[model samples]
Target: MLSKKERAEEDALVEEELQAMGPKGLLGMFSTKGAKKKPKLFLELSKAQQRVQGKNSLVLRQLDGDTMSDKLSTYKKTIRFHILAAHDEAITMVKELRGLRQDVNARDEKGRSALHFACRMGSEAAIATLIKEEGSVDEPDLEMRWTPLHYAVMGKHKYAAKLLLKYAPSPYVTVNRRDKIGTTPLMIAAAEGHASIVRFLLDSSADINDRDTYLISQGMTALHYAALTDQVKSVEVLLEYKAKVEIRTKASGETALELAERLGSHLVSVALFECK
Candidate 1:
């Protein structure tokens, strides 16, 4: 056993060594201060790691979003290109798009389908293809409520009109189908001076004297439209088909001849007068 003085001297030397070793020394292993500080440092490092991981995850998500948006944009542009190609009678390109799983019945903003464009462009071959592909023959547009047949007649496409009539699920329904203003295909044919189409419609069981029952042109027949538009040949055809010459419009109460005279349609007026 050492003397009290010797014990004091040894304790002093141990304190000096501990002070020099600092917090990371062997003495720190049993020190509560060092224990607390180590846990705090570890927590800070973990928080930094989590922040880096969060930033990386956010960047990955943003990249994915951008990639998806680009894909969607590309898809829309491709679809539009194929639709325009259909209008230009690019049947092969359309078929290719269809083969790639694109919707064949996709419509434009105005609800005009591929078949409608095909008819408006007078593409007989494209019309045939669309019909074979199960395109709706009597599909009506959202704007004018005009069917493919109506477009065919409006564009003076006789063959396209014939194809529509031939492929229509119901011939009678399609031939006499009316528009937004209650104007039937025959009425449009007459108004546009499409005499041959008028004759075709009449032969196809279109009501020759079917009247427009919609707004301004209410109670106006095919003959009335022909006469008002100065379509002499159409008027003659209507008369030959036994169109009512005396059928008066509900709005104006004018016969076909009277409407012709009022509209200054000299040729149509003569034809209606001769028929009367």
Candidate 2:
């Protein structure tokens, strides 16, 4: 029979072999005659299990984060689709999504918000809903930097414009906000021949003689746009609102009357001349 020291040395060797084989070898020890020899192998197995559990937990958390991100993206797309549809059911869907805490002010690829599309489409109900939900009114698109008020005026949606003006956090900022080319809502209204919108903008204290920063339209006011576009009624409205007809283009130094005459806008030219 081996001495006590010899048996102890043999136990140490077996333990070293089990550790080198890892948790799998520990399981094999259970089926062997050496199973009962070492009780410390159970501790090694427990440590291996703990490591696997930790890795699994990290993977689960990452999946949850991805799921939340996907839901938010889908919600944004659905809201935009509803705004484009501009019907009662679509508006209802938007409201439902908003009630679920979805972002009402989420922008599309063009950086346009729901309020911007609502105003552009002249959806009065959608506009009211988004406004009541506290969506931004003065948010500008990435491309044109146009606010909701700009779209309303451009579309000649009088009531839509009224709603935006009424609910705007800052009436002056919304009314006088400029686009990428430095054209204000008033300038768009005048150029589009939207006489009513032009008048409303003027009454709302829009800058009547605001000039654009574009090369061709530089230093041109709402009056110049109306005159050049042959917008007779818009010209009349601007004149009634006391738009400065004396304002001249930067490059051409031509006043609204001169541009009107050169463009052959007979009615607008006559209006500008009379105003002068």
Candidate 3:
């Protein structure tokens, strides 16, 4: 074992190496004018370190007077910020830190998991890494009961969605697996007119007629959601899957065709009417 002075010197060297490999340095590798550009992730990483170190540890060491939990909360925030900002290197570093017992599962004030942030930023690689690390894909944020899949759809990130589906399938992929409006993955895809996703989900054996008790009545199906949104293609896809055309909502007591007509989606109305 090294003497106290030698150990201190070794620790100083390790800290210097870490700082050199940090976000600011990583940015320099991308942009020649990085110093002029001011990478926000560098600042976030600094905040994260302060958070991981905890104020209480500093106080206990007689170095400062801050609390441990407070510092940890701040670190969690920084981890989220880096994930949201699409800082791939930063995310890698954070995961490594978390693997070293830095608390990777920490949630932000919004209750969004890091996987949600990767989806929001359309970072497929980061998302893939998180999923491989067995990160929670089912966590909901503050709003929309939105999971990573919800963010992927809203952000229009096909690749990120694809990555998620590859690593973790829906229903099994999302927690409570329900949207804020109480819709499922198939329901959200239908409502948003995402025909491809609709088709994929249907092919994946997602229940074509799953209905949420909170938003609509028990009888409503994916076709009902599709027709309501005037998504003609979605309606056709559901119909092709043998979805019940005559399904009705408890609140509206209207068939898919009737709802389609009300929404002025003539194609969907016509298709539903033609359905057996």
Candidate 4:
């Protein structure tokens, strides 16, 4: 009974709604005729919700509390890591995710939450999206104190660390955040070879001199860790940031340069030894 123009307008609106779902659009909702039928994940989603809310109430809520139910759906879907980070496409996804579930939050198996993934992937856009979409920006995962910025530093994603610092710098700067191994982001970056992250943190006014009391004093400063790992560039970067040259690890009783020598890293030793 509708006119052609009205019908066309309605079609366009439906198309827009479909697009609005973003990465989760059309998720297990359709059955292609004659195609091999895949198990419907939404069925599992419904079951999960039913478990949370009794079946009768859930059905009632779906009918009378449609908006709330939609939010719950969005939250559940966001928790799943099925969607790739898709950093390049996060802005639009941000709008959609926020609009769908303003309170969306979730954690992965290793206790690395969405924010952690955002940092590890060096997606500033995704970080912004998570902040604007989810209210739990500063929420630490199972590690209790390790924030997304911490992961960024450990992952050696400088831009991600920078963005995290810019948007949601943890209030507990000097407070040591430990992982399962009681290693701080600074320690992880130092032990491995993430020089850029060390420089970024130090330049951002991070407590370069702070030592982790929880861990054995493996020669605490970013310089000692970098030197131990034979990270030449990292050594130079940390030294430029004024990391102490003479600092020694508690257990090993070795200076950063000594660790570099013992590891057979001549270049790393040269870089650290040459530091004033």
Give the best candidate by lDDT: 2
lDDT score at residue 234, model 1, on the 0-100 scale? 93
Error of 4 at 92 (Å): 5.4
- Model 4 over residues 1-276: C-alpha lDDT tens digits? 345585456445544544554533533322245657554333234545633553334332433224544433433344332133324347555655657632235543224456666666566776777766643545565634567767677556877766666665463452245554455677677777776666666666666665554455443566766766777877777777777777777777787787778889899887876775
**Cα lDDT of model 4 overall?**
0.58
CA displacement after TM-score superposition, residue 207 of candidate 4 (Å)? 1.8
TM-score of each: 0.69, 0.71, 0.66, 0.62
Return the candidate ranking by lDDT, descending.
2, 1, 3, 4
lDDT tens readout by residue for model 3, 170-256: 544442267766677788788788888777776666777777766444556778888878888888888888887766888888888
Root-mean-square deviation of every model: 29.8, 23.9, 9.6, 10.1
Model 1 residue runs over 4 Å out of place are 1-94, 97-100
Give Cα-based local distance difference scores for all models: 0.70, 0.71, 0.63, 0.58
Q: lDDT by residue for model 2 over 81-150, one digit each (tens)?
A: 4334244234664656567745666664345666776776688887888788777888897767988898
Candidates 3 and 4 compared by TM-score, better number: 3
Candidate 2, run of 10 with poorest lDDT: 57-66
Candidate 1 lDDT score at position 131: 81
**Pairs with steric clashes in candidate 4:** 219-249
